[model samples]
Target: MTDTKAQTQAKSADAGHASAPKEHYDIVVAGGGYVGLSLALSIAQASDLKVLVVDPQPSERLRKDERASAIASAATKMLDRLGVWGEIGPASEPIRDMIVTDSKVSDPVRPIFLTFEGETAEGEPFAYMVPNGAMVGALSDAALKAGVDLIECDSVKDFAIEGGMTSVVLESGHSCTAKLLIAADGVRSRLRDLAGIPVVRMDYDQVGIVTTVEHERPHEGRAVEHFLPAGPFAILPLTGNRSSLVWNERTDDAKRMLDMDDFTFSLELERRFGKQLGELKELGPRKGFPLGMTLARRYIDPRFVLIGDAAHGIHPIAGQGLNLGFKDVAVLAEVLVDAARLGQDIGAFDVLERYQRWRRFDTVQMGITCDLLNRLFSNRSDILRHARDFGLGIVDRLPGLKRYFIEEAAGNRGDVPKLLRGDAL
Candidate 1:
């Protein structure tokens, strides 16, 4: 694909100027994040659809991110099918084991309540820990190579629908019309709102403190989730001797902690992290994101559709946040491509509804599941804690149940998309 800058410059001026020539695209994706990029690459597989990604952020900036995410097995397959996994796989670390515990930060004994050995007979690990930058870089490379046009340093300012075509106006003063518009602008998606889609939100009033830590001892790819009274604290293994931490806590507490001096924050982290990793040194940047679940009322509106966090945002309790977004990309890509192959309008209501019907149920279920789990485990009620612990122990002992969980975490048990199943769209 040609550089968007050259395309824009060749077209017209950026400021107050004469009417710019309208660029037409088959699919116009808003927000060039992972999900949007993945969707663009998938659609470009046909080499027929003219797709454009509108994002305010530059690729270089996205590739400089230091955060990490958990990539489920199914999601890995999706990337592989998209010809991106091979590029990013070397930087990813497979999750070989997981331990779940219910305890307080001050608890002297944090007994492991449940442990899962995450391995499949297919020799596929359940998940991988991937740096945010690595994944973004790989996806961008693949999207560009596959001929997906990316309008960088500009975003969808607003859009209008006339007939079957949706006209999108970019902040750069560029105008483009497409048969379909995918809103992947993230949790606070402006495109979703512009399309008049409403979301039902269940705020947890908690925040997830995310950062990386270099430990003295090797984690051996073992992950840990400690269900503290406030929320879940997950220590996910990374390559080398580092691990990414998602420490959840009350919103107020998290705010205060984030404001604390480095030494103070380290002391607090030590209390929750324990000495299992020998010694711990906080690395890179630390961030606190408010936790909640938000599900859009509809995934589609006429020629417009929502994907990724624009469609649904759930708690990261189970580390399914990014995986869910990838799942959206996989299914949306398959639906749009299938419709195109059949000579049907990809943005037609009937065509778009297929993706809605296929994904809404699954999205709702995951949202509620995360909500229930957070409520069930994040508390100090002894009776409730004991019951949940007993349940965890039971599940741990039952190999069949453990396998079920592993599959679920691997994202292989849902309405399987061909892309996620390692098949081309």
Candidate 2:
């Protein structure tokens, strides 16, 4: 790992900002997506961090709710730290319970049905379902309140690591230098590439079809996960009896599915989904994304660190992608804030190493778990099918084991951050 703090100071000194009189910031976060924005806000609240957020999207036009949604628990706490949770609370939905089942077309039978109920020590629910756009809006508002600088409709045209500091040139012909540079630019991060950090990539040969649907009957705060031959079909609870669906299928089949008419799509969805919710109506257009995993060989270099999808991308089988990103924000924020409070070099390798140690294991575990689940369930083999269904049945019958799985799914069982534990940051 590179000592970001030393590199930052060295770069600042080389840039001679103190002597030349130029605009500089303590931290510059590239890519204003969920992870980037959340991190900027969290860091800004802890210190007069002088954070700058650079993105190509206009802030005013980023508020429209998208069909995509995330399962938030730990993420909620991170948002609370940034003071955006309350703003998005009204539009969010609580998931009180979840059902996991193993189904087969050959037998047309469900061999196992497992139900997990959520629990929270606080008055709040265990997890929330939030739309992507709503999350972005809340983060944007919180960032503004924290006095973080926002550079919209702009992208990093070039970045160079020299003399200990990283200099980034924006497409708008603006140049900025920062003690530390964090890339939340997503899985295909250009910055990470430019920094020469290689990633181990795995393609799952699967595609996730995501959309929201309104059912005749209320969801009653219950979500469902059906393990089918193609992949898992997850129906996450949303507000007003609506459910957000992430249906994973074969890559080639998914392309055809996206072109499916509403009537055909609804029928196909209902087949795996069942008619438990009575009649179902499509709420909006459906979108699909290819599923894959990517883990950067290194999480940090001198004056640079990766967060969110940029650091790791996993299958959505567990709906942990964004939640994991939230964890990154929480851990990175805590580490950086503590370092700053001690007057430690915030960009030093020592400070950045703390974050890497905290998150790397967790990220690898999650990636492997999701990959294994994808493999175990996404096959038509009878032996594996029987074993998985039997495993589900066994867990369902064991109360203690069932509760453990529930808590894990709810993002409550871990070395959690204070914000995730519902404490003030």
Candidate 3:
């Protein structure tokens, strides 16, 4: 594809600014992943804010991510408003329904405790499964087109608040200043640490085995989650007859499984995967990621702020991790844009605090909810299992309650940002 006018300008800026003493931008996001790119794009497109994204990974590497993510309805709305959803929609598979089951690994038959026909009041599917690569690619292209500067193969090594702006030092020794510095870096964010923000953390002692599979039969857009003693195993339908797996297992067992022969791994996978979709072949490389919950004690520090995984990292039991990050992008972008429009200092404590106040409680609540659900369901206690199953069954039977859950899962719940609701800034 040909580069856009803004992309050409960004390329020229990269070359021209390489040896410059110091550069300045309205906002500098210290990570070019989904959150950072989306935040940069949203602000740049909505306003004339000069946004810059710095990341250690190159754009080519970012677009090579093999994983997929569940894009909730609200997030999709935001993406649509950003003008990139048209590119992403063709590659996404809408989730038509979902079923939840709690059973042991050795169980001969697993009965569903909860079944949800995935749709919102507006008749949109609650979520869609989208390739991570597609998401990053589209967001990156749109961000660049929207005049967001991107510096790849470099990252924010450190930064300090100087006067009303934050001075950032990159790993390559280049420096820049921004009205606001955002740490959208991953969960283990060095920028967050540099800002001296403390975090509340909990180790799950579990690892999520993520991979894709091609099945003989189509999934019909049905997503499945099986709650085993070790953890939840999810089968999320992808485009065509493929599905993505987020299989959780104890750390030690996960390590063993990763080292197993393909045949052995396939057998074990089948035991959990079942024959519902008929024969399946593993597609692409599989990876295991350690699971944990990490929430920043404070979301802001002067001109510095945290967003996405840098702010909160939760369990995937409810598939809400990415959605939560999208929420952060929506709220922070809205707050900053509003501040800019009001001629207020976007990096000032009062302005940043508004964002912190709006997001902190929601982040904490979701983190705690995911933590509790992970603990409650990732156990072998028969009494607790029965009680939880009964509760799930009751919730399934209550249409009002089910609708509430569907709305929540769709990210259409309380205090939504205008962007998330498909509105312009």
Give the clash count for each candidate.
0, 8, 0
Candidate 1: lDDT over CA atoms?
A: 0.87
Error of 3 at 78 (Å): 0.4
**Candidate 2: tens digits of C-alpha lDDT, residues 277-396:** 899998875988889999998899878899999999999888899888888988898888888889887788889999999999999899999989999988989899888778888888
Question: Which of the two, 1 or 2, has more TM-score?
Answer: 1
Global lDDT for candidate 2?
A: 0.81
Pairs clashing in candidate 2?
A: 3-349, 4-303, 4-347, 4-349, 5-347, 5-348, 7-164, 11-165
- Overall lDDT per candidate, in order of appearance: 0.87, 0.81, 0.91
Alpha-carbon runs more than 4 Å astray in model 2: 1-22, 105-112, 122-124
Ranking by TM-score: 3, 1, 2
- Residues 134-194, model 3: lDDT tens digits: 9998898878767777888788878888878888898888898999899999999988887
> Any runs in candidate 1 off by more than 4 Å, and if so which?
1-22
Q: Spell out the clash pairs found in candidate 3.
A: none
On the 0 to 100 scale, the lDDT of residue 109 in model 2 is 65
Residue 112 of model 3 has an lDDT of 96
- lDDT per residue for candidate 1 within 31-125, as digits (tens), equals 88899988898889854898887777887899999988999998899888887888789998999999998987778999998999978655799
